[model samples]
Target chain A: MSILIDRNSKVLVQGITGRQGGFHARLMMEYGTNVVGGVTPGKGGEWFDGKPVFDTMRAAVKTKYADVSLVTVPARFAADAIMEAADAGIKLVICLTEHIPVADMMRVLAFCRQRGTRLIGPNCPGVMTPGEAKVGIIPAMVALPGDVGVVSKSGTLTYEVGFAMKNRGIGNSTIVGIGGDPVIGTTFVDILEMFENDPDTKKVALLGEIGGSAEIAAADYIKTSMTKPVAAFIAGRSAPPGKRMGHAGAIVDGGEGSADEKIQALEAAGARVAANPEEIPDLLS
Target chain B: MKLHEYQSKALFQEYGIPIPQGRVAETSREAGAIAAELGGTVVVKAQVHVGGRGKAGGVKVARDAAAAERHAQAILGMNIKGLTVEKVLIDEAADIQQEIYLAITNDRSAGQPLLMTSMQGGMDIEELNRTRPDAIIREHIDPILGLQPYQMTYIASAMRLPRAHWRSFLKILSGLYACYNKSDAELAEINPLVITGAGALLAVDGKVIIDDNALYRQPALTAQRDSSDEPESERLAREAGITYIKLEGQIGCMVNGAGLAMTTMDMTKLYGEAHGIGPANFLDIGGGATPEQVATALSIILSDANVKAVLFNIFGGITRCDEVARGILTAYNAVQPEVPMVIRLQGTNAAEGKKIISEAQLPHLISAETLTEAAQRAVAAVQESA
Candidate 1:
């Protein structure tokens, strides 16, 4: 069994009428995800890809009984969409929209915590369980079904690592992009717990970048909690200090978030740290 | 997204936080005039985004108007940490009885906004937290409940603030919170929240870093952006809806996603360092960018003369590979780039993209099957060209 999602999990696509939402919703269905329903505020009663669209998440979940939701709304309305999904009882929500205001994310995060609903990303590529279900925007061709579970903060980096693993005949159990925003829904520790519990997952590969204490926290968790062998890659090792490396969260600030510091912490915690993506397969082996 | 000290103070003043009367001046004569209006005893502080302006000699106390002119003249044209000082804030000097530190910033680990206050003020808070952690008091604010009065009082008492200054301090705290929330600021800080000899609490220095994500909704705050401090390419990239950061190297990278772009840069650096070449710049065309946007990104990369070879790493998710290929061809024809290029396309419609590239068979272009191969080829190409 894969972590977070599987073959039987029904998914709801929030903001399904929008360009990105519609496109990815179709892709998810093509990848064997159980696309159950769609939700749009003003476009109710419309059918997208044989799924009924509802104006509100409550009505859609009530009729379709979805267990998970893919939020594809714009950044301005993403927080409300997430809160609606949580209130409608979707246990797991994956947000694909990026650039969500930090304050809006703080409120939504607190709300999701109170309701015990798991949120993946507000600026992420989403999650995928290979050979079962795919949610969010990760290209399905890059990932193959296997025993290694992957978690990362960057979307393309996940693809790069997954492609490398695939080239080495190392398929993945599940892959999660927790997003590269300063404030994200899920942490490395959260995904690590799931990977450790999944019996199909024999090992994990965590792809991290220079920012935040999430990797350090994950290292601490791996040191104390897990028995699975983990190989990790931290990007932006040579990035200049005080410069943002594309991602909003990928910045070295106050000497706190740096590749050297993250590498040191991960190494001390018994995790093999790969210097480059090409080395991840060997480290895991 | 970082506002100048003067801009931060303007927002603070709007929120009822007391600030020393200040005027921004682009000229030394204007600074002297402002200092004369403020009774001749003024502080000439350079306006730049980088920290440690005081250490950089960007800040000075002018005892008279003539001194103010000299100080402004010296600080205005100076470069502090690669950012040139274009303007200076001339403000009335305060008679400080004591200094305090107060700021509101996001605590990413807690997924909440943290309000931090310290008795030790006018110093680097990070340094203070490192050396004297006990001197700071932190309170996590509930986004819904906000900064409660009791929470403010608790922090004030924890910092051992005098009872006489508690009310005004609370007002400043609330005002700062309002500014942070209303402005969509990632950080709203008053480094030295000073208590004057007249027993008045004032925000002596202020800093506000607005969240770039929220800039779309904040038109007024976005208008405060000083693009002069950024590189010309960065400013142009922002206008073109791409993310670009110029670096010191020979291989220019154009990638689809931020994470992938950084990884590409890292890989380029790793392989290029061995070959005595490194990534020249960081450019992300972002998700679902059009062919024209890709063309624009390529032009930006080529605009830098230091680049000897261009590396294109595209993993199509929302970004279609064929579109990126078309954009590359468009840029190749338009810019007539003399430098060599190594391209790697994968995922959505990658075969179609590869067919497009092979069909064109542009001169000096090398196609690779993977990121590692592409980086290696680009590094080798740059070294060969050099």
Candidate 2:
């Protein structure tokens, strides 16, 4: 009853030869994710943890069908990586790379949108359908299959919220990390709409920080499109004005992008606000 | 990664856009010598990372070399919004026939570069965009083919640039876009892209923000960065491989996780409002930072003169709270800021962790029962400081 994935979904690892790709692939495989095949440019007929490796994604697609593709390549090459996966008939693509140039992401998003591919993050933590497919870098030690659907832009906080939820015997249907890149492929509204439509997901835990109109846009969606209980925790209430860290889009400008401003907007939309990370689990419950 | 006007103009010139003849001077003597060499009325602008300098007494019109020297002396050592200036940009004053604004940046919603243009320039364009939305001409450019001739023409027409001047406008736009792509700029802006009385379309003021990630590839640009423009603490953090952003609040934040950092700040405000306290800054030492790094992170937060109290929220998984506590103690020994600190230790080894902090016998440091209590304690401490 997970949102983006379930037990039947098979996953493919792109750029599997790289360090981050290899590391996360093993983690997903260890977590019992149905990691079907690995793709590298020239390293074919190789074996990583008893899985077949192919030179190109096309070859990998022909031999093994992957419902989701995790793109772990560098920023400059992320666009081509996603396009290759989409052309090969992969339905979902989770971009794990950070600092993907904004312009490159636009072209990739355009290419994927035409093909009807669901892109999770160009800077996001990949999706995790708990107790099923853990395709992202979320600490699976804390996740359990439950009714709460947690989505966040911050990586480590996602783990914390998941830990808090698990601590309270509240498992999660799925958790999505919408990376904090300014020009990410997916937004809060997109995931909220997805979580809203998933009947297994009884509640949505939204984690946002100071930056952009994403929070505002999410509030607009919740007010109109979504019909589920959304418990949101807007972080960076004490964010320094007009400074950006890690994420390019994650900056405050002209005092407009503050955590309080976001929380107020979310509260106006009828969502319960978790003032602290610990309060998130109880709010979701 | 904001570029000063003079630096931005350097990039604009590389893109073939025309700019007022200018040189950057660090000393009043240099300012006078450069102004005298240019032999005209000059604009002396304080070189700081912040905006609103024009109103902050950071920018001034100098009638001649002597005035330029006087203005430079006033600006170079002046403090604009906590950023002390060390350089002044001396430029030939423009004739300004017509002024317009143009900029390009990432629009997260459209997942593309948003080209913003307006006929209204030299002031807060936000006001105009809010009041008269139609006044701001915007287009989402396709990244693959880059900016097209037709799109530039559309913007040129929207700004009501004389039909005879469309060619120059098109050239500037192309160069700007090229500069944006080639230079790996996150933002390339020419506010008041002026048309001189001599009928020349020029980028009088330029701002190019190079993407920090791309700095490895752009060595020439990497060298051009003025670290003096950044806050002393921010530069120190950069050198330490920590991402620290200074904020104006009362409660100082020190958290191990970026996500936890945000939640700590959010909760502090929630609790602060409940108890009439506010946060002074947001600090994320990052998960897996050594105890020493944790202590260093604390010192940075305490370095802010505005901070009244410190909030430590460490979620132990990849980061152990006991290690973070040790860092706090180590940092306390090093910086020794006479401020209150409240820490909530959770995840791996939570109890053994709380005992460690208590055993340290540190003054003004409180051990909390939970994250809520910790945030409340921090806010109360800050309010007490007030």
lDDT (CA) per prediction = 0.91, 0.82
Residue B283, candidate 1: Cα error in Å is: 0.8
| Total clashes for model 1 | 0
Per-residue CA lDDT of model 2 for B222-251, tens digit only, reads 888877767788888878878787766788
Worst 10 residues of 2 chain A by lDDT: A238-247
Give DockQ per model, in order: 0.74, 0.55
Q: Report model 1's chain A TM-score.
A: 0.98
State the lDDT of candidate 2 residue by residue for A11-80, as single tens digits: 8899887888898899888888889988988899998888888988899999997789999988767778
Top candidate when judged by DockQ against the true structure: 1
Q: State the TM-score of the second chain for every model.
A: 0.96, 0.87
Candidate 1, which segments miss by more than 4 Å at Cα?
A: B274-276, B317-323, B348-352
lDDT per residue as tens, model 1, A137-231: 88888888999999999998898789888888999999999999989989999999999999999999999999889999999999999999999
| Docking quality class, candidate 1 | medium
Chain A TM-score across all models, in listed order: 0.98, 0.96
Clashing pairs in 2: A124-A179, A146-A171, A146-A172, B249-B279, B249-B280, B250-B279, B250-B280
